[model samples]
Target: MSWLRALKATARSGLTVERRRLEPLVAARAALGLALVVGATLALFGPGAAISSAFGAFQAAIATFQRSWRPRPTLALASGASLAVSTFLGYVTGAGTHPGPFLALLAVWTFLSGLAWAAGPTIGIIASSNVAMMLVTVTLPTSVAAAAGHAAMIAVGGVVQAALVVLLPVRRWGAQRDALADALAAEADYARRLRQDPVAPFDPVPLMTARSAAAVTPRQARSRPAELHGARGLAERIRPVLASLADPAVGAPAEGPQRDRVRELLAAAASVLDAAAHAIRHGEPVDLPPGAVAALRTPDTVAILDGPPRRAAVRLAALLDDVVETAEPRTETRTPTPTETRTQTPTAAGAQTRTQTASQSQSQPKSRARPTLLRLAPVVAARMRAELRPDSPVFRHAVRVTAVTTAGYVLGSALPLGHGYWAPMASVMVMRPDFSQTYSRSVARFGGTLVGVALATAVVEVADPGVYASASLAVACAFGMYLLMRTGYAVSQVCVAAYVVFLLGMGGSAWTQTVYERVVLTLLGGVLAMLAYAVYPAWETPRLRGRLADWLVTDGRYAASVVAHYANPAGHVCADVREALLDTRAARIAWQEALDRATHEPVRHRGLSRAAADDAGHALAQFGRVAMLMEAHLPERGAPPVPAAATLAEALRRSTERGGKAVRERRVPEWDELRETVANSGPLMTDPLLRKGAGLLLDALDDLSESLAPPTDRA
Candidate 1:
C-alpha cells in the first residue's frame, strides 16, 4: 500500500459514523459524576482545582467504557487511582526548575504506558488515557502542597463515580445477559438457516462474545445469575449438532423420509432455542411453541432417521431441554433439576443423552475457572514480562511511543508555545501498535482539534462566558462525548478537544495562544506519532506465516483430541475436548487479527502470498469443521470402540505437528503419514462417517500443500 492510499483508508475509517444505540441513562450517570466533581471543587477550592478534578472523573468514566471483563466500578476506581498517582508524581518532578528531570520522567512513564499493551487492549487503553491525562493535569499544580490537595480531589472524583455506579445501576449485568442471549439467538437462527441450505456458514463471533462475557471475576462469580452459567458452552455445542444433522454427507440422504424429518427437527430446535434466548435475556416466563415441542418429541423422528441422524435429534432435544431448564427465570433460588422441574418419559437414548449433556454443560461453571481481580495482577504482570523480548510487537510499540513522546515534548517545548505538553498528549492518545489504528487516530485527533478549537474559540469571542458558563460548556461537551463514544473515535475526539478548550477557558487565563497555535501543536504531535511508526515499525506481514502455523498446530491438536475420543470414550476427559476447542479458537482469532492488521501495512507478504494464505486458512477451517462434526457424534459410554481411530489419531497428531513446522520453515506441508494410516485402516474402520470426514480433511490438506508449493513445481 502507498502512503496516500493508507491515509485515505485510515481517514475513511476514522470519519465513519456508526449507528449505535445511545445509552442516555448511562451517559447522564457518568456526566453527573463530572458535574458533581466540578461543582464541588469550584465551590470549595477554585477553578484550578475544579479543572484538575474533572479530568479524574472524565478519565474514570472513559475507563468504565473500555472493553474489559472486570467490574465497571472496579475499572473506574483503578483508573482514578492510577491518574492520581501519575498526577502526584508529575507534580513532584515538575516542581524543579530545570525541566530535564520532568522530561526524563515523562519518557520513562510513557514507555511503561506503551508496554502496558502486553497486558491486553483494556489495560493498554486505560494506561494511555492515564498518560494523556497526566500530561494535562501535571501542569495544573504549582507546589507540593497543591499536588496533594489536587490528588486528593481527583481520588474524590473517582469515589463519586464508583459510588454513583453502585448506587444507581443501569441494568445490572446487562452486557453479560445480552452476550449470552445473542449467542443462543444466533444458534437458533443458524438452525433455521440449515432448513433452507444445509451448508450455511455459522459465525463464531456470538459464541466468542458469550465466552468473554461468561469470564467473571471472583466477586462476580458469587453473584452471577444461575442461568448464565455454562450456557455459552451449551450454545457452542448446538452449532455442530445442527450442522451434522443438516449435511447430507453425514446425517441423511439428499432427499427422502430422513431428510424431511431432519428439516422438522431443525425448525423445532430453532423455535425452542429462540424461546430460551428470550426468557434468559428478559427474565420472563418461557413460551415454548407447542408445535415445535411436539415435532421434537414425535416418535416418528426416531423411526425415520437411524444412526447419526437419530443420535443428533435425540442429543439436540436433550440439549434444548437443558437450555430451557437452566435459562428459565425464577426467584432468587437454586435451579431445580430436570426431573424436579418437569416430568416426561425417557426415549431409547434420551435419558443417557440428557445425563451426559447435564454433566458436560450444567455441572461445569465455565470452560475454565478465571481468576479474580486480586489474582489478575500477577497474571497481567506475567503477560507483560513475556512481551519484554525484542521481537514482540508490544515491545516495539513501547520503544516507538517513548521516542515519539519525548521528541514531541522537546519539539513542542522548543517552539514558543506555552502549553508544550499538548503535543505529546495528542501523540500518546492517537498511537497504537498497528498501522491502521495509529494512522486513523492520528488523523481523527488532528482534524477534531481543528474543528474543536475553532468552535470553542468562536464561543469565547461571541458570548464571553464567565467561569461558571465555561465549566458548564465543558460538562456539556463531556456529556456529548460519553453518549457518542460508540459512534467513532473521531466523534469522541471532537468532544474531547472542545472540552479541553473550554476547561482552559474556565481557568480564567488571559488567552495568549490562539486557535491556530493549538491546532498546529496537535498536528505536529500527530505527525510525530505517524512518522515514528514509519521509522521504527512492527509489520504484521512477517508474522502471518507464523500465525498460520500456530493455527495449524492447534487445529491439528483439536482434531486428534476428538478422534482419540472415538477410540476410547471412557478414558477421554470431556474437558480435554473443550480445552482443545478453545485453544484452536484463540489461535484462529490471532491469525485473523494478524491478517486484518497486515492489510494496511505497506509491505509484501514476505513468505506467505495472499493466495497461499487464503488457501491455507480455508483448509484449516474445513479441518476444524470436520473435527466439530466428529465431536458432535461422539460415542456413548459402554459403546463399542472404533479401535481404528486410535491409530489414525496418533498419525494425525504426529503428521500435523510436523506439517506446522514445515510451513514455518517455508516448506510445503505433507500429510503422507496420515494418508498412510487411512489406507492401512481401509477395512478396519467401523465408523463410515469418520472415514468419509477423514477423506474430506485430507483433500483440503492436499489443496493447502499445492497452494504452498513452489511456483515451478505447481506448473
Candidate 2:
C-alpha cells in the first residue's frame, strides 16, 4: 500500500461507528465515581485538588473498561495507586527551577510506558495513561507540600472508585460470562458456515480470548461461578469435529444422502450450540432447541452416517451433552480427573485430548489473574526482557515513543505556547505500537482537539461559568467519553479533548490563549507523531514470511507427532501429539495476526506478494485442516501400528524443517521428501482414510510451495 491509500483506509476506520450493546450500568458507575471525586475534592481543597484528583478517577474508570480478567475493583485500585505515584513523582520533579530533570523524567517515563506493551495491551494502556496523567498533573501543584496533598487526593479518588465498585456492583462477573459465551457463539457460527463452505477458514481468536478470561485471581477462585469453567475445552474440541464432519474428503461424498445428512447434523449442532451459549451467558437453565435436539438424536441420521461421518455424529452428540451439562449451574462441582489434575495445558485439536475444566484451572495460579502481583513480577519482567532485542517490535515502539516525546518537548520549548508540555503529552498519548492505531489515534486526537477547543472557548465566552460549574462540566465530558467507549475512537477523543479543555479553563488558562495554543499545538503534535512513525515504523510486512515459516515448522511437528504416534502407538504418549497440536495452533494464530497487521502497513510485502500471501494462507489452513481431520480418526490405544508411518513421519519432520529454513532464506518451501515418502507408503497403508488424508496433505504442501515461488520461476 502507498501512503495515500493507507491514510484513506485509516480515515474510514477512525470514524467508523460500531453499534454494540451499551453497558449503561458500567458507564453510570464510572460517571458517578468521577462526580463524587470532583465534588468532594472541590468542596474540601478547592478546584486545584479537583483538577489533579479527577485524573485518578478518570484513569480508574478507563481501567475498568480494559479487557482484563482481574476483578474491576482490583483494576481500579491498581490504576489509582500507580497514577498517584506518577503524580507525586511528577510534582516533585517539576518543583525544581530547572526543566532538565522533568524532561529527563518524561523521557524515561514514556520509554517504559511504551515498552509496557510487552506485558500486553491492558498493562500498556494503564502505563501510558499514567504517563499522560503525570505530564498534566505535574503542572498543577505549586509547592512540595501542595504536590503531596494533591497526590494523596489522587489516591483517594482511586479508593473511592474501588469502594463504589464493591458497594454498588453492576453485572458482577459479566466479563467472564461474555467472553465464554462469545467463544461458544463464535463456534456455533463457524459450524453454520461450514455447512456451505466445508473447508472454510476459522479464526481461533474467540477461543483464545475465552481462555484468557478463564484466568481467575485467587480471591475470585473461591467464589467464582461454576459455569465459567469446564465447558471451554468442549468449545475447543467441537471446532475440529465440526470441520471434520463437514469436510467431504473426510466425512462423506459430495452430492449424496450422507452429505445431506451431514448438513442436517451441522445445522442442528449450530442451533444447539447457540442455545447453550445463551444459557451460559445469562446463567439460566439450558433451553435446548427441541427440533435441533431431535435432529441430533434422530435414528435416521445416526443410522445413515457410516465410517468417519458416523463416528463424528456419535462424538458430536456426546460433546454436546457435555457442553449442555457444563453450561448449566451444578449443585456441586465434579471432582477433577487425574489427567486434568496433573496437566495445566489445554488440549489442541485432537479427539484423544481431554479437556481441563475451568474449575481445574484454580490449581494453576500462574495462568490465573496473577494470584499475587508479587508472584507475577518475574513473569512480567521476563516478558519485558525478551522484547529488549533490536528487531523486537515492542522495543522499537519504546524507542519511537522516547524519540518522539523528546523531539516534541524540544520543539514545544522553542515555540511560544503557554502549555509547552501539551505538545509532548499529545504526541506520547496518541502513539501506539502499530501503524493503524498510531495513525488513527493521531487523526482522532487532532479532530477531537479542534472540536474541544472551539466548544470550550464558546461555552466560557457565552456563560462565563464559575469554578464549580467548570468542574461539573468536565465531569460530564468524562461521563460522555466513558459512555461512548465502544462508539468509535474519534467520538471518545471528542469527549476527552473537551474534558481537558474544561479542566484547563477552570485552572484559569485564558480562554483565547488556551484555545489558539491548544488548536495549533495539537496539530503540531499529531504531525510529529505521524512523521516519527514514518521514519522509524515497526512495519509488519517483512515479518510475514517469518511468521509463515513459524507456522510451517509447528505444523510439521504436529503432523509428524500424530503420524509417529500411529507408527509406534506403544512408545509415544498422547501428550506428545497434544502438545504438538497446541504449538501448531499458537503458531497459526501468530501468523494470522501478523498478516492482519501487515495488510494495513504502507510498504511492499517483502519476500511475499499479495497473491502469494492469499494462496499461502489458504494452503497452510488446508495443511492444518488435514491434520485436524486425521486427529479426528486416530487408531485405538492398543491397535497394531502402521510400520510405514514411521518413515513418513520422519520425512515430514525433516522436509518441513527444510521448508521453514527455505522460507526464512526467501526461497520457495518444498516438501519433496515428504511427498516421495507418502507416494511409497501409499501401497503399504491399509487404512483407506489415512491414505487419502496423506494424499491431501501432499497436495496442500505442493500448492504452498508453488504459491511461495517467485512469479518468474512459476512461469
Q: Best candidate, TM-score-wise? A: 1
Candidate 2 residues lying further than 4 Å off, grouped into runs, are 331-371, 568-573
Clashes of each: 0, 2
What are the lDDT figures for the candidates, one per model? 0.84, 0.80
Candidate 1, RMSD to the unseen true structure: 2.4
Candidate 1, residues 252-364, lDDT tens digits: the string is 77798899989998998899888888978887767787777677766686668888898887778777877877787766654443233333445657677767876766466
Predict model 1's lDDT versus the native: 0.84
Clashing pairs in 1: none
For each candidate, what TM-score against the reference? 0.96, 0.92
Q: Could you tell me how far off, in angstroms, the CA of residue 354 lies in candidate 2 after the best superposition?
A: 13
Query: Which whole-number lDDT from 0 to 100 does residue 65 have in model 2?
Result: 92
